[model samples]
Target: MPDTFQRLYELIDTPRFAQGGVPRITTRKSAEDFAPRDEGLDVLLINTPVREWSYPNVLPIGQGYVAAGAIMDGHRLTRLDLNADRRVPISTLDPGYDAWLFARLDEALAGEPDVIGIGGIITQYAQIKKICAYCKDKLPDVPIVLGGGVASAMPDFMLKHLPVDYVSQHEGELTFSEILHRIEMGASMQGVAGVTYYETDSHGERTAIRRNPPRRTMTAEQLGHMPWPLRHLWDIENTYRVNPVGHLNQGRKWNQGAPESGGKFSAEMIASRGCPYTCEYCFSDYLGTAYRSRPPADVVREMEYLHYEYGVEYIEVLDDLMLTSYKWALEFYAELHKSGLPKRGVEWGGTCRTNILANDIVRAAREGRGNMLELGHDAGLRRVAYGVETGSPTILKVIDKSGQTPATIKTAVQETVRVLGYASCSFMFGSPGETAETIRETVDLCIEMDYRPEVFFFTTAYPGTVFWQLALDKGLIRKSVDGTVGPADDGIIERYLMGLGEQGDAVRTNFSDLPDDVLLQLTNQAAQDLNSHNSHRHPYQDGAPNSIVRDATHATI
Candidate 1:
């Protein structure tokens, strides 16, 4: 909270204001605060801190926090469950929070954990930097290992910039556990695959950096059997300020009935890993494109634990692709049914692709009691909104999205109405080959599909994707971010790029046929025509961090 800093500012400024001059008093660390600290503690894992301004949710818990569960692969989604078991003691903490939150960090750090693992995403760079800087300042000898989406996205960037000791990309289960083991046993990281670190100068500035080739992606079996996340490692309940019963929520509403403690408990989980199909704009597209599915039994078991143990009556699956394999869907349905987990276990939804939703697949997904499937703008158009990125097949082919032809896309969107019961669609305005004629083609396509426009996402080039290279070649993104510091407000770049991803003005386009002003007008026209459906549901009603989600739908599930 800002209360602490605000009060200090007042105390110092009050004196200066009395004399009608600016306060020249400087604030320095107290003797006790700046005292020498021990860096030879045990293991400490951190989930970088967050605030409401940075992350808008019904609750203020940070995103990418589920790294513990991720390290366990898709099998476990919450950490509180992991700490209950005999596992590694790298307790996760979000100490960069309020005063009370700092207390929780103090308790976790009281053990003086020597190895610290910090989990973060791209948008949390500034916060992660602040946390790592503080940790190094206090415990200079301890090794701070950074991992998570941002690390996975750009391992070299983190190694070159942040004051971290080590960084790991991609799946961290094998590598992180190995790193921890070596540190505990007094070994070296020279042979560790998927690790990067900097050789720093005496002043803590990076002098040299070395990164190893990433380890191969985990096998399907490896992902399914990993241990659960160590949620017990952190005081999450108090840290997130969770008020499950009633709080501002984004996206779909989950009717979890009534919360045991007025909706005080909730969680987000991932049931699968990677996506089968490749889209140029996906952040992780640059990483290998192969996808993996967790065993259904393992997925259900995680759900069972959360529903019963954490009192998480509602859950949301945050997966790359929640529905793909028909065989897996059938097995998953059987597991959920046979397990006899309460209705709470199935109250969820996840993103699906256009080609994954066959009749049998949809039928199997609907077997759950409280499940739902939400489609991304570039998803399988069944009951969800069709992703009509552009009307022109020429543009589609140019962007290497020939998979979404007029026939295939229209048929899917039309069939979805009966199979899933509602229709929403997403469109993109600017890309490599967008032109006036292409824009018209998109508008006409929306008319044909009867698309209920949800939101228009003006796409950008994320670092690991093919689009990133294209953007670079075309001068869209000019400079490399390795040595450069990002905006002081880490969220600025993400917010500016996505521009309220659900609904807002599009970001700058790199289209060839039209200027940005013309592209804007064409996009607006297409949006109006697509959203012209009389029954178009409000997009905000189906945004993120909802009450519950499912792989398919509420009526069928």
Candidate 2:
């Protein structure tokens, strides 16, 4: 199911909404004033909501500056510490419910664009469908295209059901351009690689969908050549407000002070595509094993543009695996410092394998104004994990976690903490061959790290992984919470979908050596113990964004 839409999927996240979920409301009372319709561009791209960010009490603080743990300072938090850092929603602080986004789309569409493409992964599938429904009624003549991992994986379901006329799959930059051109020229879409479309049968009924072979993996040149939309496309003037949290660096103690004044924003970018490590549960297979990244010069230029043009103070680097090569990382920092954006006083960080955090590389990143990181903490539990997914060495072979071992992981974690100073670890529970001893091993590691905040996840095989195929082959799926497996594929699909779409839901799809109930209990208890640091009291103890259209100065780092 890997498709051209992988890039689109990367830009999307699973926070805020359950997978395959949609907002209860659709279409404002008014639609004629939508802005993007008037942008006069050939194509309009909509990066719909469920964007990865943290929100207050109800929303999970999956990724936030406040997740940075403040020193206990001999101050044990009471019941009310959580609300002390409560952030006002941008919706309430500005316009509500992404109305601003719709407003911009309306303005662009008002300019009479040739085509409109909407992209999101499973997290936003239902939302995408809802938007497509509204778009169909509003812009009946404009050909609507759907692209992203959700489209690639669910082409049939989307193309057949949703109002979208075309679904662009795997690596969409080239395919999307061609799609727009073909639509404009009235050319047949037969040969367009990495696209799926439907033809009308003689009776005017939708026929079987057509798919083209996937295009080659994206290259560094190709990625850079693509419209680097640092300035264009995004409604930055409106949405790129600064974070209320100051300068946004780690070790900055939380302010019990009033939420600060506004006029700020944070931006995200990727200097690269594809992670080098082959963590089996990840969708890296879809990304192509070959890692590709932009030139350090290009990365720095974009950072400069974001900082100067957009007033972006903190930028999050969104590479799943960053710092893969020390030389590449060094070049990146050297370019940044020489380029003087380091002098611009911007802060940046990323989530990547701890193995890449060589002491020198970490030193360079700090020297270049980089701070904060989410390292691959899986390697630290040598006795309990390999790349963070197995307890038994035998299971490592089953999961195909090659090029990694306990010793290597231990060294990686040690080096990361040595340079970076802090780490937030998330690990898998309920893996094949798991046992009480293995679980205790993990607990020991956590304690060794000083209960250095962790999240334990129930392991389930989402589609498009070596793990999924293995589970299917070995019949580890359950029909219901009660662990029923039937003769048909319905339960299997149900279990898989739940795993993919719902992160909070526990899935027990591991081999029979370990029972789901026990696995669930272990993870729950571990999380409870780790969270005694008053997880609620420290909710992203950072700050929120300023204005929806624009406001807020800093965020918790």
lDDT against the true structure, each candidate: 0.50, 0.49
lDDT of 2: 0.49
Model 1 TM-score, 2 decimals: 0.65
Q: Pick the candidate with the highest lDDT.
A: 1
lDDT of 1 by residue, 1-557 (tens): 32122111132225443343432111111111222213122456665532211221222122232233222221222221211111111112223234433455556556666677776556556657766777777778888888777677777766656778788776655566556545655666776777887655779666777787776676576555444443443453542224332111222222212223444455556677777766776665222346888788877777777666556654555566676676676567667767775333334444554544534335545774322232221121122334556657787787666366766556556665554555445567678777788778877776776656555655555656777667656555432222232322233333333222222323433546566556555555555556543112222122221211122211110
lDDT of 1: 0.50
Error of 1 at 361 (Å): 8.5
RMSD in angstroms, all models?
16.4, 13.9
The alpha-carbon deviation from the true structure for residue 276 of candidate 1, after best TM-score superposition, in angstroms, is: 2.2
User: Which ten contiguous residues of candidate 2 have the minimum total lDDT?
Assistant: 65-74
What are the TM-scores, per candidate, against the unseen true structure?
A: 0.65, 0.67
